[model samples]
Target chain A: MIRVSRYQLVLMLVWTVLATGILTMPATMATFSVRDTWLSSWGILLGGTLCAGLAWCHVRLFPDRSLTAAMELAFGRFAGKLAAVWVVIWLVITLATICREFGVFVTTIALPNTPEYLVVALALACSAYLVYLGLEVVGRVNEFLVPIAAIVFPLLFVLALRWFDWTPLQPVLADGWLPVWRAGVVPAFAYGLEFSLALQWVPYLNNPRALPVDILLSAGISALVLMGLVLITDGVIGAPVAYLNYPVLEVVRAIRVGKFVERLDTWYAMGVVSTLVLKQAAFQTGLAEAFRTLCGTRDPRWSIWPTALLVWSLAYFLFRNSADVSRFILHTVPGYFLFTAVLLPLLVYAAAFFRGVRPASRAGAGEARR
Target chain B: MIGLAVGAAVLGVLFQGWQAVRYGDGPGAGAWTVWGMLALAAVAVSVVVQARWWPDANPLGWLAALFDGITSWIYLGWSA
Candidate 1:
């Protein structure tokens, strides 16, 4: 088996939590909360922390098992396989959504006139190679890419600050806390509950004890970045952010400092592509791992290809339009991700307790004490 | 004859330089080649896993074996 350090896992989690939400968060939050857009990021912080914290407990219970394997530990073999199937299917659908969204954004923005199928296929192919190499390589690749996002996001925020106006964010809580909470909580599931996928990386962590802190820190950093982006986007573009499909792109297009810094799409594009690759690789790896467990196979490398085919087909062929992708992410994703990422693990934990099943390591520890 | 010539060229390009043509040109195509080789290596690895693990049956035949044991393994527990 391959091992990854806690630091690597945390880096990957930050991408998982932040990637898809970068462009969409500002618009979605502004749409719901208006001037209270920044207010909703608090809900993001809370929702992300809580979802990850629950997954932390799930990891604590099954230190040595992947999420799917833990389901096997809780349920009978057949039902365990059923649970694994459910998780695999969820990963497939969600991954296809992310892949399709990636295709839409890249083809529409960066590489127009290029075939969408080719873009999606090539991207997934790269992600498949990362999966084939296993988690350690995936973690290292993400570690390399993190600096790109870390640098680009803050720099983008600073450059876009020239347009920041205080008026747009005024009258905070005009609609009170309800709308803010509603706006924040929904996107939190979109960004936060995905921490559950990090639980699959738990068994690979070199320092298992560090998992909780790393989990929270990753989500916390994501929330902070998300919160700052929302505020900056709102302050810079004001009420118009609500209407823009990609507020971050608008924020990028708005940046103009002398001749050199005008419309820093090149910088912004790097950030977008970096996060997109990281997120897709994370999902593809997780889906392949869960799939291997389901098939009772020892290796997950080959399985990545088959799963890539499914993701490619669903992304390019099945999903018809970019609007459908947007609607699905906004309307459908929160509840769907909540069930699989949060509630399913919680149920599996309950089942573990009901069956009086404990982690093998814990049992060994108890025996040692005796 | 011209249509046939064009079709042959297209097929040859797809077969020989599919990675370059399918992905793009320049650095992008180079990145595609590196990952494309890795993807092909993964397909090769799957064959190895198949031969090593399930020489008698299909690669994913664990479920098939479990299906036969359905009545016996209905009750749940560790490794049940």
Candidate 2:
């Protein structure tokens, strides 16, 4: 019912494309990955892109409806509902993880005295309000915010150049590709988080023809940003970056540009806030859509409270703490995301191709080719 | 309502103490920011809770909620 321009959608994506995924989790990952963190980031990018491409193929296969509808067409009623359930659970988990991340960052850096739950509650209310306004507002806000992030991130590094110690990254790839590959775990699947919303983004984009390309471009741009951050942080702080609880904040704190622009992490914190807002908004909107599908309703506004309350309660129990959440992500979530966002779509796309049953003319791949 | 308010106030006091313990050490004075953040958190908890109960209720409630959301990162190790 709401119209969103391709530019707005792409902007929304740019914010989600970065920090919320790999950069947010890199502190834990750097412990395992070591100095090869930047290279590993690229490795994850390749893996996530393949998954996104596969999902895009499925979207192409069923243009009129989303993955939920496509599943109904491909499998019967029961299996379709099951697949829809998986998608919904994935989104709910994503929402909760982001909320926890919000709390972790706040308590660790800015508000040590505050109750973690309070910070999370504040984040949730903002996201709920955004979802209530509909995707268009979310998209426009993302457009405004993403560019500020893009500008500030590089500026953070430039300011840190005064403190740059190139020796730490010197033994680059010293531990070999094994550690790098392991470290890339966080960034690799980070972009795939956005793929969870393919069901929603597919319908709203002004040019479905350009959607995949834009996603691919967004992925590439975000990957570069991750690489730059990894390289700069590693170069500045070296292995100590891995030890710090929150590497990005540490990197910002390390910046002291000739005494005039000290304590810039406060500003860098704004970038963090903006990215989390966009990521949370995207995930919640998708969650709302899935609820609409499951309950057989066209109205998302009516179900917002139930969905928010459920997500809040679920996030409460999902993981024991930030460390537990990080461990779960390190060990399990990537492969699960691969199956849902990557392999399943490919399976469906191959079936459609082999069956000689042509999907709509302007669906995913068809439009991409045009 | 007062019970909840008192509970939040107690949390505020604990938070301020926690800030003093964590970042409120001698030399840096970063803990002053911590005190400010604790105050912000108290305001945030009240605001967010109110919004959840009765959204679009009052402009003051809305502003407090927004402040908390945007400033949630103010207390982190790097955020301040």
Candidate 3:
């Protein structure tokens, strides 16, 4: 059986959540809560912690199965298949959007001359290969890249201290807690809700006993990093950040020490772009796993490339330009995430409850027989 | 370059799937049938949406557009 150590597992968990959030959270949060983006990040903490808590509860109930498999036990065969298929659809479009989102960032900012489709295709290609190799290999790659992101992101924050201003964050909660609650209610929760993917791999962890602590650390760490990024991006870029698309990029672009080291957004993108690709890979892995369970596939490998193809197609056909990508990310995505990650799962949980499923339910172990 | 990459992906999935089938992880007909269809769907992306209300007339997009309204109402009806 494939196995990953806790350290690798934790890093996979961290990057799976942080890779997308690091780039967009500051500005995305600013779009709603404005100058109080930092305070608004409390939504991320609470929602992330709660979302992680939900995943933790999910695995606790279905200890030996994936989300689809757990749903089979919780709901029953037909309903479970229906729910899992929708989850698959969610994975397909979300991965498509992630690819498109990152592809736009890369072509626009990093590789100005490269074709966007090519960048997206290259990412799906890498994902197909790593996913066929399975999560252990993907975990190892993340072990290296997450630390680079961990270090480089913080280093950028420290270097950008030259432009950090406290006045922008002042006039705190001028609009009261409603906007904070609104920002936290959906957007931040959706970001944390990405942790839903981690539940798919929990049953395979070699040391399964430490699962909650690992998830908690992952949640706490991801939330802290996002909140920190929000603080620095808003502090450095000020109120304009609310309207700007890539606040963190501008923060890094603004750095200039003795005129020697500016234009470091390229270096920053170098570290983050891998994290983004791996994020898509990581999501593709879980998506394929869910696909396998629903299809009764002979092996996990059957689903990888085919799923990659679906995502590539969706990435191409979904959005027209960066504006379409941004508008979808800002408005459409959170609710869709709410559907698959929160509401759908809660419906299954309700089914489990109505049917007398418990945290210690042993229905999980024998679920594969179905 | 794109052709080579897509070809590699197709072959890579075949190789990986073949290994599992050889090991008798399970049998192939049903799984491979579905895989072939999906791979074909991916390769023929432009053809899939040849004529539609919008160029992006994906079934997945339809589902998202459908349920997003329902779920958004469920989640955002009172809050946010």
Residue A83 displacement (Å), model 2: 1.2
lDDT of 3 by residue, A298-363 (tens): 456776875676567557666767677665665566677766777777777677767777655333
Among incorrect, acceptable, medium and high, the docking class of model 2 is incorrect
Clashes of 1: 0
lDDT of 3 at A345: 73
Report how far residue A40 has shifted in candidate 2, in Å: 1.3
Runs in model 3 lying further than 4 Å from the true structure: A353-370, B1-47, B50-53, B56-80
Query: Candidate 1, residues A1-370: lDDT per residue as tens digits?
Result: 6689888888888887777788667776665666886767755566567666766677567776678878877886668767887887678778887888788888877899998878887888788888888888889988887677768768878878888898988877777776676577555766677877876765567776567777778878877877888888888888888888888888888878887758687778767777787788998878877755554444555456656765675564335587666655555566566667777888888888888776658324221110
Chain B TM-score against the true chain B, candidate 2: 0.35
- Model 2: per-residue Cα lDDT over A1-370, one tens digit each: 5667877766676676565653465575576665677776675457546745754675566654556556545654466556766676667667777777778888887899998777777777788899899988888888777567668777877878776677776677777766665566556654544544655556555566566666666667667767777777777777777777777778788887565968988988877876787788887877766644443434445445444554554454455577756654554455556566665656556655776545665433222121
Please tell me which model should have the higher TM-score, number 1 or number 2. Answer: 1
Candidates' C-alpha lDDT = 0.68, 0.61, 0.70
Candidate 2 chain A: 10-residue stretch with minimal lDDT? A361-370
